[model samples]
Target: MPDKPRLERQAMCDRLAMEFQNDWIVNLGVGMPTLCSNYIDDSKEIIFHSENGVIGYGPLSQEGHEDQHLVNAGGQNVTQMPGWPLFTMQIHSL
Candidate 1:
């Protein structure tokens, strides 16, 4: 097989974290989009609102630490906000 190039997902996330401002309320879409959340700055007030009701989803988990039961819409297990709420639907999307 021939060698190919690939876009580093973690690098993309780092950029998002660097670029986002404190007041941003960003929604990380499923797949590559969701990786953006990792780039967020901790000092800033950027909130990653997952559709599943999670407010401040934490950093991406490492292998072996993943729990299938607590996965996001992207099917990746994520960290949760301290007082994050859980729900079934998004009323605003309507």
Candidate 2:
């Protein structure tokens, strides 16, 4: 059988992002999942949630323009969209 062509990073990310619908809250995992935010349609009102407590964020920060306060689970700085909220999770000792 002929070897199948593989999707490039951005194309793969775009394909994964297409699964989300408008007004849905999406939790982005570490690494490549973060890239999905950039592929979402502008018309959709998808909310990006980071495990570190950022909610309703935009996309990954461009080079040299990172915000010191916003970050995802993987420590990559991300962009803040309108109505972004911050929160903290407390772990209760068992």
Candidate 3:
């Protein structure tokens, strides 16, 4: 059996976060994309958008403090930024 080497998830996220501009709006997907929030440069005012109607949310919530009402597209609890509005979509059919 042979062991395979893999890049640390956080390290990969830190690297990917560097590719965006300071004021860019990023739509992060599930899994690895979620990790990018924790590594983005603090100096940069990057806005994170989730498909689950979350806008301007910060990194993932800590254990035991997860909000059941607040979750990402991946169904993971997320923390919202101050003054950010949560949008919900309604579908109308004829």
Q: In order, what is each prediction's RMSD in angstroms?
A: 6.0, 3.5, 3.5
Off by over 4 Å in 2: 87-94
- The global C-alpha lDDT for each of the candidates, from Candidate 1 onward, is 0.69, 0.86, 0.81
**Model 2 Cα lDDT, one tens digit per residue, 1-94:** 9999998887899899998998999999888898888886988999998787788988889999999888887788888888887677799999
For this target, which candidate reaches the highest TM-score against the unseen true structure? Answer: 2
Instruction: Give me the displacement of residue 49 in model 2, in angstroms.
Output: 0.5
The estimated TM-scores of all candidates read 0.65, 0.83, 0.77
Could you tell me how far off, in angstroms, the CA of residue 35 lies in candidate 1 after the best superposition?
Answer: 1.2
Give the CA lDDT, 0 to 100, for residue 20 in model 2: 91
Better of 1 and 2 by lDDT: 2
Ranking by TM-score: 2, 3, 1
Off by over 4 Å in 3: 1-5, 88-94
Give per-residue CA lDDT, model 1, range 1-94, as digits (tens): 9977775878767775688887787777677767776565658877787676566676666788875656655878876655556657546853
Report clash pairs, candidate 2. Answer: none
Worst 10 residues of 2 by lDDT: 80-89
